[model samples]
Target: MTRVDLNADMGESFGPWPMGDDASLLKTVTSANIACGGHAGDADTMARTMAMAQGNNVGIGAHPGFMDLAGFGRNRMSVPRGTLQNQIRYQVAASVGMARAVGAKVRHLKLHGALSNMASEDAALARDCYEAALSVDPDLIVMILAETAQQEAVRELGCRWASEIFADRAYNDDATLVDRSKPGAVIHDPDLAGKRMVEMVKAGAIITESGKQIPAAIDTICLHGDTPTAVQIATHVRRALEAAGITVQTFDGR
Candidate 1:
C-alpha cells in the first residue's frame, strides 16, 4: 500500500482528571477514535475532543469499551450477549450524537481495551459489537484488528471496514497482541515504534515476534494516546512512513 491511516485512542480524560496530551497528539494523527463515556470519557470530554479533531481535520470514530472505568476497560468482563450489544449501541449513539452537535461526524467505529481484545478472538463478540454499531449508522466503517476474528466478523457482516496494525504493541505468531502485562509488550521507544510500523506497512503484513509475516490488507497503524510518549511515537511514525515514501493519510474503508 502506498498510503495508510494513523489513528489514536482519544477523548479519555475524565472530569477533573486529565489524561494524555491529546492536543499535541492530534497534530500528528489522521484519525481519532474517541471514547464514548464508557471506559474513560464523559460528555464534556467527548465534545471537547470532537471539536478539536474537527479543527485538526482528522477523521473521527466512536471508541466504545466495557463500561468498567475502574478497570479502565482493560480488565475483562462477562456480561450477557444482548446486554453487551446494547451497551455498545448506547456508547456509539452517544458518540454520533455528540459529534453531530459539535458539527463533526464520526466516520468509523473501534472497540476499546478488554472488549477489543476479546472481540479480536471471538467472531461472535466482534459481530455482535459491529452489528450493534451498524444498527445506529450503516455507513460507519468497522475498523478491525487485521488477521483476527475481528476481521472475520467484518467480512461476514459485509460492511465497510478498515484493517489496522499497532505502532507500539508487539504481535504473536497468530497475530494477536502480546499481553500488556508481559515484558516488552508495549514498545515505549519512539524510534523503535516508528521503525516497526514502517516495516509492517511496507511488508503489507503483520510481522510477528517469531518473524512470521502474515499477509493481510493492512490499512492503518494505531497509536495509544494514553501512553507517556504517544505524541513522540505518532510524530516519528508519520515521519518514518513519509521518509520511506509511504503516504500517511486517512483510510477509506473498503
Candidate 2:
C-alpha cells in the first residue's frame, strides 16, 4: 500500500490571542508542524500544543520562520545567511526544549511562511536553514518543498528529510506555489483539495495550474490549519486517501 503523512502547520497562537483549531486538527493530521517563538508561538503556546499533540499520538515538528510577529511571518525580509541560520537554530532549540518538557520529541523541522517561500527558490538559504536545524539534532527530519531548491539542498546534505506538497495551494509550472493574490490560488473547497491530493499521490507528481506534471518525491501532504474549514478539509483528504488504499501515517523521513 502507498503510504503518505498528513501534516498541518499549527500552534500559532500568541499569548491571549488564539489562532487555528489545533485541537480539532490534531485528530486528523498525522504530524503537526508547530510554530516556534520566531513566527507566532510563545513558550506557553508551544507547551500547550506539544502536550495536545502527544496526547493525540501525532508526530511533532518545529515550524520556524523569520521573527515577524506583526506580519505573522508571511512578509519577506532579506537577512544575512548567518543571521538566518542562527535564528532557525534558536527557534528549533526552543521548540526542542518545550517538547522535552512535555515528554514529546520534535521529529521534524519545517520552515514557515516567508522563510519557506524564500528557501524554496534559493539553495544557499535552504542549506543554511537545514544545516542550522541539523546542527541542533542531526537526525531531525527536514520537511522540504518537493522538487525545489529546498529539496536540492537536502539531497546535497544527505540528511534525513521528507518532501511535501500542499493540499490546498495551486502550483506554478516551475513547482513554486502560485501567488496567493491570484484567483484559485488557495483552495477552500474540501472536495477539490481532497481530489487533487489523491491525484498527486497516485501520479507521484505535482499537477500544476497549467496541467503540467512535475515529477518529484511525494512524502507528505500539508494541510493548512489556519483556515475556517481546515479540519473538514483534512478529514475529507484523509478519508479520500484511505478509500483509494493510501495509508495515512507519520513519515519516517526515509
Candidate 3:
C-alpha cells in the first residue's frame, strides 16, 4: 500500500488571542508542526500544544520562523544568515524543552511562513537554517518543500528529511507557491483541495497552476489549520487519499 503523511501547522495561538481549532485539527493530521516562540506561540501555548499532540499520538515537529509575531511570520524580512541560524536554533531549542516537559519529543523541524518561502528559493539560507536544526538534533527530520531549494539543502546535508506539498495552495511553474494575495492562490473548496492532493500524490509530482509537472519526493502533504474550513478540507483530503488506495500515516523520514 502506498503511504503518505498528513501534517498541519498548529499552536499558533498567542496569549489571549486564539488562532486555529487545534483540538479538532489534531484528530485529522498525523503530524503537527508546532509553532515555537518565534512565529506565534508562547511558552504556555507551546506546552499546551505539545500536550495535546502527545495525547492525540501525533508526531511533533518544531515550526520556527522569523521573529515577526506582528505579521504572523508571513511578512518577509532580510536578516543575516548567521542571525537566521541562531534564531532557528533558539526556537527549536525552546520547542524541545517544552516538549520534554510534557514527556514528548520533537521528531522533526520545519521552517514556518516567510522563512520557509525564503529558504525555498535560497539554498544558502536553507542550509543555514537546516544546519542549525541539525546541530540541535542530528536525527531531526527536516520537512521541506519538495522540488525547491529547501529539498536541495537536505540532499546536500544528507540528513533524514521529508518532502512536503501544500494541500490548499497553488504552485507556480517554477515550483514556488503563488502569492496568497493573488486570485485562486488559496483553494478554499474542500473537494477541490482533496482531489488535487490525490493527483499530486499519485503522480509523485507537483501539478502547477499552469499545468506544469515537476517531479518531487512527496512524502508528506501539508494542510493549514488556520481557517474556519481547514478541518473540513483536511478530512476530505484524508478520505480522498484513502479512497485512492493511499494510506495516511506519519512519514518515517525516508
lDDT of candidates 1 onward, in order: 0.95, 0.94, 0.93
Better of 1 and 2 by lDDT: 1
Q: Write the per-residue lDDT of candidate 1 for residues 1-254, one digit (tens) a residue.
A: 49999999999999999999888989999999999998999999999999999999999999999999999999999989999999999999999999999999999999999999999999999999999999999999999999999999999999999999999999999999999999989999999998988888878999988899999888889999999989999999999999999998899999
Model 3, 180-210: lDDT tens digits are: 8899988899999999999999999999999
The C-alpha RMSD in Å for every predicted model, in order, reads: 0.7, 0.7, 0.8
Model 1 spans with C-alpha error above 4 angstroms = none
Candidate 1 residue pairs that clash: none
Candidates 1 and 3 compared by lDDT, better number: 1
- Which of 2 and 3 is ahead in lDDT? 2
Deviation from native of the Cα of residue 242 in model 1, angstroms: 0.2
- Model 2 worst lDDT window (10 residues): 78-87
Worst 10 residues of 1 by lDDT: 194-203
In Å, residue 168's CA in model 2 sits off its true spot by 0.6
